[model samples]
Target: MRRRKLLAGLAATAAAPLLGSGSVQADEALLGELLVTRLRDAMLGLGTAAAAPSSPEALATDFTRALADFDACRYASLAVRLPRLIRVGHALSTSGGDTEQHTLLAKTYLLATRMLVKMDEQQLGWMAADRAQQLAQSTGDVLAVAESARQLAVLARKAGWHDQALSIALSAADHPDLRGTGRAGAAVRGLLVQSASYTLARRGDRDGMRELTDEAAALAKELGATLLRDHGGGFSPLTVQLHRISAENHADDPRAALDAARAISLKALPSVERRSRALGDIAVTYDRLGRRSDCVRTLLAAERCAPQETHARPATKTLISSLLVSGPTSTELRGLAERSGVLV
Candidate 1:
């Protein structure tokens, strides 16, 4: 009876929550890792070619849906869907070779590249960006090529190659695509300028960051509209200011970061990803200020707004883990960390 009772007690203890196997955490971790590996395979040219035939119209529609999820910051869903989409896109690209179909393929990979970058798969993201750039070049569209350069810049920024990113954006700005003085040109110009701004910010060049930001803002006014595309070519005044908030967080004082963030209307952000990112940045600023309660609240808000980003993005996850380790040890903060799968 004593041995049986001891065994029962051990079983009960093993079933305890949080750190226990009852939550099926192994499955979740496997799924996340599988998704990451699939992305790496696709980006690094190791993916298997499936016989799944896809039509251009169908692929275009799927790409549009994926873009919707992307802007909505439904990142986990995107991670599941993007690899298949990229594969099918490449498979179909080899067939008829129509310009419209080719452009659609480029856009598909373009979206994939941007999503991969946000997911913090740097090497895979770099290859995806290059593939998108190559496809854009094949499409013979200068604007598409310019956008590809912008994507390359993003990958470079993430990889800590800030100077390379800055050069790519600036050189792309002078492309003939921007010579027309049209909305497209203004948009591309604004995007490249802002890209340069972010690079400068990451390098701790405050004055350079400000000057390029102002240039991007002027271009936004010249266009007199919002870009709001999946690619950075859709950069606008709000987008520029959003980057300003990010730049402030990186370069200026923590208080200055919050002040710059406050200067803009948070709800006016063009996409859920951008909005959540701004909140995450603010959370980081609060963390730096050692305002534990405010930091937890902001991080919780960000996760509520975009759970996938909170979980999948490197910087946001770092914030959550930082809080988990050193921030206040309370029910609320612990609950937030638990929900994010950060504490465990």
Candidate 2:
């Protein structure tokens, strides 16, 4: 009954905007709560798998589609697919000792962790990350393991465990299996290093953050192209610049963040997710610098880039709320807050 209610609510939320309800704002917090609960139940082995067993080949195709939805910032579609995918992936992994099944399950859980983190469900995020790490290690895939570690690091950092987050990221970056594994290995290593650098920035270690950022940039340069691996993707110079925006923002260098933002263009990013993320960073940085008009404009641009991300991400919602009550407002800002379901 509870699961059905939650799923129904999610369905309505996803459909409300598309149903010509121009003034309706989906309750993103309610959506997150429902999703986290559903995901937690699925992770606890409480859900029934599909009646018919799916072939590994079939499951692979489904997973690829789900991943594409994630990459394209189709959060509504991805959220609807994730719980069932996790259940099926769990069933297949337990049915046999197939490393491929385990790998797929790990990837599923890793994707769940990412979503949970974006929604700021840190406790559930931790659970998903732990499961991903365990399953990835079981597969003996170094890149998979490194990706899981990166997610874990992100969760830890969000939970205020800065040192632990840094340790996890740096350790994964230095993993022996990742060494000399060519471009793929370098890409994963770059992600880990970038994650660690952000952790350092969060800890107020500006110098350390810059040093590690440079290291990650070097690896990105070596990759020569934005390698879109099964992992989180975007291990290129552009991505490094994106990360720099957030890092500088964290380090109380809003000017530097804006400078980094100037180096990026939405058209050059690999996916809508990255583009919206970049715009969100720029928006936040503008808020930091008291550029209210710029902040609102950038946030609107982010909404244009990926409405799902702008409407559903917790940080974006908070920023909208902040803009609403911070002082003078505009028609566009109010409309954005209304669309994002931010309570004024």
Candidate 3:
């Protein structure tokens, strides 16, 4: 009986160690996973908390962070971060299940969708954008819905689905709920005009593009929404884009085109993508003006701003080639091309 008791005690002692080791292993594994998750969340700029207040200042801060990431060519990071932040912001705004929260959520989702679209993740963008639209509709938030529709239109355009873009933008414009709200209606109309203009531009219809731009500008003025007058968005960068496009259509006046392009380039230095686009435009304008040295310099600046690989790469390459042809001997241009690695 003593031997039997001793054996049982030994078994218990062994089992205790085994069980403790197993438990420790399990805990260690869980901790590793948690560490990984937290790392990923940090890389994406997400916080552990929910949302914050809906003040413009708060929104602006969020916007600034997102924009900074975008300008730094951190598209994937921005894509992950903006959506999470926006979702949290929505949650905070609508914690009480208020109609205002619902509206704010829809808008935040729209911003998230835009970031996804910019990152070339169309499927996810469409899903989120559609969900935002549904939420806006449920809340009877016509302005929010209109903005959502406009974002969807942009996605469609980027995907080369011109018809879809037009339909969505026009639908937003015609939403009955927006009719009474001057600012909202005007904004929707501006989107429609911008959509049409882009479609026409893609089809190489210069006259149609001009007409739409004029119409969009007029409507924007009427509503006191001058932000989109030069382009679709209400920011200096978009304004630069508008000026550059205008210069493109006025080939005969190379000086005017160059002036506009230079202005855009100067204004876009802080933004990588915008700077690349502006530099490309400037190079093209300089080429048209027969300013060989200036064209080469502008092309080189553009090359510096471009991502190693981006949706804008092909266009940037074309601009480089045009500037090269207009500039110094093929040797210098070839050296620049090799350095950029954009042209073999």
Candidate 4:
């Protein structure tokens, strides 16, 4: 009886954060949270079991589910909850007899944490990335470590540390394990090269940037990888917008940048938040190209599509402000604002 009570107490404690009460909609949220909580607990239990007698396959399953949840709720604060789970997963794989499993798990954690950082949850993401990097080194997982270094490079660039970003990116590109690891997919290698190239370009190493980008593009073509596929041409959607922005920076023709932005906007329209962001970017690109009419039209379209949420209002306002800034506004712009019921 005591044991049973103790187990029940542990279960309730684990589940408390996910449980809520109120109306039907609240219950749905509670249910979703509960499901995520239960998955997290199961992952913990699997890790414990693996520690006793390592089971790489079970650990992989648990990590996959945890990853899915993390990806789904990345925009929220749920990304902060992933590092501990990743640590347990890394432990399970490293302790197990499967070298492949160890390498993959370590790399996945590193990549996922990097993605979380790009989502603007920098602190938690960096902590997780740093932890994954340490674990990868401990396990002699050089490829995983290189990948983590690449992530750190990108983060440094985002934080305005251009020189540091360039150095780290070069290091990632030159890592022996990264060059030698057959386990790492071609797409991953392409991204690493592409990132290195972009960083070089930002640092004004034009020849180096061209050489690297050319190499990356050729490799991507050889691997049958699209340079502008969904989710930034990688497996994750985290860098989709960033990739477009980078491509625009390097594009010789303004139309190329406009095309890239349009592609992203088309891909993002299914999600309200992403749609608003993509539209705003498109408007900015048009403004940069001196296409004031195009900019105004796009902004008007964005305002119409934007949801009435507090988070979306600011972006809407910015678009409106931009439309007003380009003097001698088009009748089409005024017509759009009036028709969309935004002119009050």
Candidate 5:
């Protein structure tokens, strides 16, 4: 009975943070390592393929749930599920499933690529993105191909292959098929240009960045409403504005970043991930402007918005470490650091 009581107490302690708000539910490093291992195993096709879904309809249901998990920032759950998903997807494709299966697999790879990019696992991301491109091409889906190009551009930029990245994005944006799909076409093109703008910003080509951003803004303006497709193009005037914030921040113009950030309300962003990321960008801008308190406050808000994003991203972790050493510390700040596993 004593042992039983002790075990129950230990389980409760382990679960305490998950039951509370604004606390790390698990060790951040352990979570990251698990994500990396799972991602690697998935890409390598190491896991047993989950029993093939009884039908394409059932497979799609699972895929939809996986995408939802990603959108909700449930990274740990997504990581655990992706390897099996990948394996089953590949099996279905090889066993004469259908175009739907191939398209679904392509989208799955794209999703994995996006998550890997966020985790700064660029090398592995490239592999996933490459597979996405191949499968997307086979599906004859212009939008899917364009989305794959966008992911490739992002990966290339991270690799410092700026020229290659710019070429990929602009070429896709200019693809003849992308020009005639009306609002959907325009939104995907805008996403491509938005990607190009960031690559230019990384190259310190402020004028180039601004030019592409303005071009993307024009496309977004033409669309007039947010275009969110299941195969993965998400854009709007507000989305352009959000990209402007990050571009300006990257260009060393925190004032401009702040101006762009100030122009929109968090409620307007479509997803918790986007909203939290906007807050994260704002937090970094505050840090750049030497407003430590504002930085901490914005980060706290971001954590409230998405605890996993706040605690798991390396950029945020670096910012937290900087804040810790920069000046006087507050109890709130220390608590945040501890909860994020930045402090013992």
Candidate 6:
């Protein structure tokens, strides 16, 4: 009994600061409490009347701005705005009195699904995505349907349904809506193809992944002159490059990943979230490559790039936690991890 107590004490002591201390925001639920509270009020139908005054066009424009904020990894800001957006958007859907107004419902749901995923509410995310798919299909909005599929692929990936995720993404790529020279068509197809590339890389098919990424890159390059409304400021040449680095990392070839990372021009990634994600992928490569100090530096850069996302994202936090567990105890590493809210 004494020996058992001694071992328990040592184990608890070792894990204490890492798990129980306030050094990390691992369980902060960056979006969780806000979502629950706002959504709960919305669910009770308390907000629909006040939100009823929203026009479909106004809702659409606002949704785009929200998407921009989301893409920039401003989750706290988004969390504050989205509940009201959903309330108003939902009211518009039922009584906006036009096809155009109805279409925003699907778009809004897609955004909601993406946000829910970021909040790690996978089940609610899937429900929102499914709602988007149904609404898109009913309104004959192929582009919205494709967006729904993209979110579905994300949920599948989160659930560890890799092959299924790839299949859903590829199916979206083959959409009849993709057969055009329009910017929207190119952007949607490119984004879907790029998403599939990551799944392919995860499955160890580097060649197949590269083929898809190159295809996306070409499409993005061809449409380089402007953004598309389908997914405004959507998948671009720089976004493809970001995916290429991430795919290489997913394939477990840290050397290749590092090489690809070096090739990307950071300024080209316009949004804070994209830049931070690219940096995080680079950090992952450094971590895998056993360049502990470099990994720590890269992660610090990522946090500086997007503090909200760096703190909220599970993958980023997990990487930091792993570094803390594996790295030598040092002021630089520990201090960075603590500041990033991934370690105590």
| Tens digits of lDDT, candidate 1, 1-344 | 99989877754543221121112233332334445665665555544433233667776776787788878876445554566577776666676658887787777777777766666777777777787788888878677788789888978887899889999999998777567747776688788878888888889998888898888888787776687476662576777777777777677667777777887786888788778878988888898889988988988788788876676566766777787778447787776666656654
Instruction: Provide the TM-score for each candidate, comma-separated.
Output: 0.84, 0.89, 0.57, 0.56, 0.89, 0.81
lDDT of every predicted structure (CA atoms): 0.71, 0.81, 0.56, 0.53, 0.82, 0.72
Q: In angstroms, how far off is 284's CA in candidate 1?
A: 1.6
Q: What digit string (tens of lDDT, one per residue) describes model 3 on residues 121-176? A: 57667876887888899988776777788788878877888778878887777767
State, as a TM-score between 0 and 1, how close model 2 is to the true structure. 0.89
Candidate 1, which segments miss by more than 4 Å at Cα?
A: 1-34, 44-54
* Residue lDDT tens for model 2, 263-292: 987799888788888999999999999999
**Alpha-carbon RMSD of each model:** 8.9, 4.5, 12.8, 8.9, 6.6, 9.7
Candidates by lDDT, descending order = 5, 2, 6, 1, 3, 4
Give the CA lDDT, 0 to 100, for residue 129 in model 6.
87
Estimate, for each residue in 1-344, the C-alpha lDDT of model 5 and write its tens digit.
99989877864543343322212345653565556666786678654443446777887887887777777777666655665578788887888879989998898899888888888888899899999999989989788899999999999999999999999999999999988777787788889999999999999999999999999999788778789645453698888999999999888899999999999898988888788889999998999999989999999998888887777877778889889998999998988888777862
Better of 2 and 6 by TM-score: 2
lDDT of 6: 0.72
Task: Flag clash pairs in model 2.
Answer: none
**Selected candidate, larger lDDT, 4 vs 6:** 6
Worst ten in a row by lDDT for model 5: 15-24
Q: Assess candidate 4 and give its lDDT.
A: 0.53
lDDT value, residue 148 of candidate 2:
86
The window of 10 residues in a row where model 6 has the poorest summed lDDT is 17-26
User: lDDT tens digits, residues 44-68, model 6?
Assistant: 4443222223466666666776787
TM-score of 4: 0.56
